[model samples]
Structures are given as structure tokens and as C-alpha cells.
Target: MIAVSLLEEYGGIIKNYKSGDFIFEEGNRPLHYYQIISGEVKMNNYNDEGKEFIQGIFYKNQCFGEPPLFIDQMYPANAVAVIDSEIIIITKDKFLDLLKNNSEISLKIIKNLSQRLYYKSVMAAEISSQDPEHRVLRLIDYSIEQLNFKKEEAGFLINFTRQQIGDLTGLRVETVIRAIKSLEKKGDLKIINRKVYR
Candidate 1:
């Protein structure tokens, strides 16, 4: 992510969003580059049956919805604020200008995008072929390594709720609960005070 001072220099403006607010809707043209300053955001879509499938969750300092901006395409999923949040956004044209003038930042952006692509690839395969326990474990392991989940005396605390884990891994909430319990029994995970640890 670009430094806050540098983003400000490139005409980035901070915007506040309430929980459940839509930062951008599916099919909308990408006009801004958005980076979180605080709180959580999710990119997701609902099926015809109103089942929500989360594409990704982003936390502070992370960027979301950038692939569309780079490709000049409409957003494929809606970006929603998971909690009251502050986000710094710059016009897409200005963002491109900033990248053009900053090679290091541009390289970082490329690296970030590559990481996301790799995650998506791995998750796609897991969701299609893996069992519930395997899918859940894969996500937890990825979050610990890539998303920087908090460490506790017990182990690395998983920040995702059971519902969020279900959404991300394409499992039902009940299935996620059962999988977590099963994993705990197998000594693959720990549940301390209802929080999952790995």
C-alpha cells in the first residue's frame, strides 16, 4: 500500500462509511483507488437464493477493488463496509499518475495483486475439492501467514467468525461449527473461550 503522506500528496481524500454501507456496487465503473484507514470491508455477492459468498475481507492498510480499476472494467462484486470505517481514496487518474512516477510503489502494487491472485487460485481449488475441515484449515493457515492474524499465548488467534469462515469457504455455518469442533478433537485446532486458535 502507498504511504498515507504520499497518498495525500496525490490528492487522496478520507471518506467515512457506516457499517453495511456499500462503498461501490457491482457493475459500477471504477473511478477511485480505495485503501482502508481503519475497520474492515468485504467484497461479496449474493446468489439468487440470497446466499452471500464473500470474495475477500480486507483490513486496515489494505487495498480493495483495484483489479477493475487497472483493467478499466466494472466492479465484479460489491464492496461493503463490515464496520464503521475510514478509507482514503484517490481518483483513478491521479492514482495512475502516482504509480507512473513511483516505480517502487508500482512494484509493490504488482506484488500485492499477485498475492491476491495466488490466494484466489488456491481457495478456488480448495472449495471445489476439499472437505470442510480441510477448507477451514487452509483458510486459517493462509490468514495466519498472509493476513497477520494476532498471536496469543495459546496460539495464533483466528479473527474470522464461524459465519465468516463459512462464507469464505463456501460452507454452511453449522458445517463450519462442526468442522472446527472436529478439528479441535483431532488436535489440529484449539477453541479457547470460543475463539479459534491454530
Candidate 2:
């Protein structure tokens, strides 16, 4: 994560967005660098049939939309606030300057992007050929690693909803529900108080 103090020192302003607000739409020109100060944001796209595919979900202290900004290209996916959120944003020029001046931050960004690329590759394979249960398990494992889910005495808690899992793995909600139950029966995960833990 980029240092919050550095952003504030560099004149980044906190902007509040209501849930369901479009932070940026697909095909829009990139203009600012954004880091979530609080709450959630998701990058997503919809198919012809109106089915939503989530590209990624970002939470507090996470940054999004940097790849397009660096490449000077239009946004390839839409960013929406998943909850009432506050984001720290700086002008594109300032953001570029910040990265150029901070080797540590730049290296961190590179590492983060590399992890994202690895996840994308794995998920692509799962979506292409894996069975529903396998895909769901892979997704949960990936989220545990990437999101740094804390493991308790029971297991690692999954914070995502079933519908979110469905979108991420290209499965229907009903399929996700069934697969989760099957996974639980197989001792792959545990359900407590209606929440899934793995």
C-alpha cells in the first residue's frame, strides 16, 4: 500500500462517494490516481445479457486504475463504490511524480501488480476448465492469500457473498450455493452462523 502520510503530504484530497456511485466508467480517460481511504470499490463489467463480471474488488488502503493511467489508455473496466467510501486522489501529474520520486513505493506497486497478474492467470484457467467446486475453492484460497484473511481456531473467514463468488468464478448463484454445500460436505470448508469459513 502507498503511504497515507505521503499522499496527504503531497496534497491528496479525500473525496466521499455514495454506494453505487460510478467512480469511473469503462472507456473514460484516466485523470487521477485514487487510493481508498475507507470502504469498498469494485472494478466490473457487464455482458450483453447484463450479467456482471467483477474484475477486482478493492478495500481500504487499496489503489485501483493505475495500469491505464500509466499507459495513457481509457479505462477498460468500470469502477464503482460498493459502499459509502472515502478516497484520496491526486492529479495524474502529481501521482506520476510521486512514483518517480519514490523507488520504494514504485517497487511495492510492481510487486502488487505481479500478484494480480498471477491471480488473473490462475482464475482464467479455473474458469476455462475447472469444475464448479474446484473453481470455488480456488477462488476462496486466492482471496485468503490476496486479502490476508486471518485464520482463527475454526478457519479462515470468507467475507464475500455467494453472488460475489459466482461473479468471480463465472458460476451461477445457484451453482455457487450448491457447490459450497458440496464443499462443506467434503470437509473443504465450514459454515457457521450462515457464513462460510475455510
Candidate 3:
């Protein structure tokens, strides 16, 4: 997102998003692509039966709402901040215009998209074969990928409830509990004080 922004003529607005705030609702017209500057955001869906499910959780610097922008369509899911967050909202006109004008930015965006596609493919493959515990581990791994390593709080930065973990991993709360217990017994992780196990 930052790469694509470099070519944009118009600068985006930095907006504050409180926890539990929705940036957009399902089927709302796509006006901008948003990049999370801080905290976590969740893209979620609801069935006709009123059961809600999370499509994805996005962390700091992660981008969402782009694919819909190009098609001039409504957002397919709701974008909500799981934590208090800051974001850059770039309008589609300006964002796409920038890409057309800047070769470097276009290349960078393409490269980034390619890597994202690969990650998504892997996630689809593994989610079917792996248990929830291992799937949670993979989420942590992806979330922390490209970390500086020397930075403090280098372990788990976002402390999530078992329910939220369940939302991401498609596990029920009880199943999530059992999976964590399994990891704990293996000495692979420890969940203490309801904070984290990594």
C-alpha cells in the first residue's frame, strides 16, 4: 500500500478508528483502500442465519479494500477495528492514477501482490490439513514475519482471546481450549494468565 501511495498525486487522510468501529459495512460502495497504520482490523461476514465469521484479521501496515475498488463495487465484507487503530484511506481514483503514472510503484505493488497471493494459497492449503493449534501457530508466524527480531516485545505483540483465535482458525471455543492444551503439553507453548502462549 505504501509502495502504491508513492505515486499518488493526492495524499490520503489518517483516520482514528476506535476498537469495535466499522470502517465500512457489507455491500457499501468502495471509495478507498485502507492501510492500517496501527492496531488490528478484522474483515468479517455474516450468514442469513445471523452467525458471524471472520474472513481475516489485519495488523499494522496491512492493506484492505483494494480489489473491490477497481471494480467500482460495494465491499463484500465489513471492515472493523478489533483494536484502536490509525489508518490511511486512499481514494481509488488517486491510487490507480498513481500506479499508472509511476512505473516503480506499479512494479512494487505487483511484487507485493504476488507475495500475498502465495501466502493466501498456502493458507488455504494448510487450513484444511492442519489442526487449530498448528493453524494458530501459522497465523503468529505470518503476523510476525519480517520482524526486526532485535526489537522488544518480539514475541506475540497482539494478545487475542481464545474466541478471537477461534474466529480466525474456524475452531469453537472449547476446541480452541483443547488445542492450546495440546500445545502446552508438548512444551511448544504456554498460555499463562490468559495473555498468550508462544
TM values, all candidates:
0.99, 0.97, 0.80
Clashing pairs in 3: none
Model number with the top TM-score? 1
Per-residue CA lDDT of model 3 for 152-187, tens digit only, reads: 353455356778767766678898788878877897
**Cα shift from native, residue 29, model 3 (Å):** 2.5
Model 2 residue pairs with clashes: none
**Model 2 C-alpha lDDT per residue in residues 1-198, reported as the tens digit of each score:** 988789977779999999999999999999999999999999999999999999999998899988888899999999999999999998898988898999999999999889999999999999999999999999999999899877988899998899999998999999999999999999999999888999
Model 1: lDDT of residue 161: 94
Candidate 3 overall lDDT versus native: 0.73
Candidate 2 residue-pair clash tally: 0
Model 2 misplaced regions, further than 4 Å = none
Clash numbers, per candidate? 0, 0, 0
Residue 171 CA displacement from its true place in model 2, Å: 0.7
- Model 2 gets an lDDT of 0.93
Q: lDDT tens string, model 1, 72-113?
A: 999999999999999999999999999999999999999999
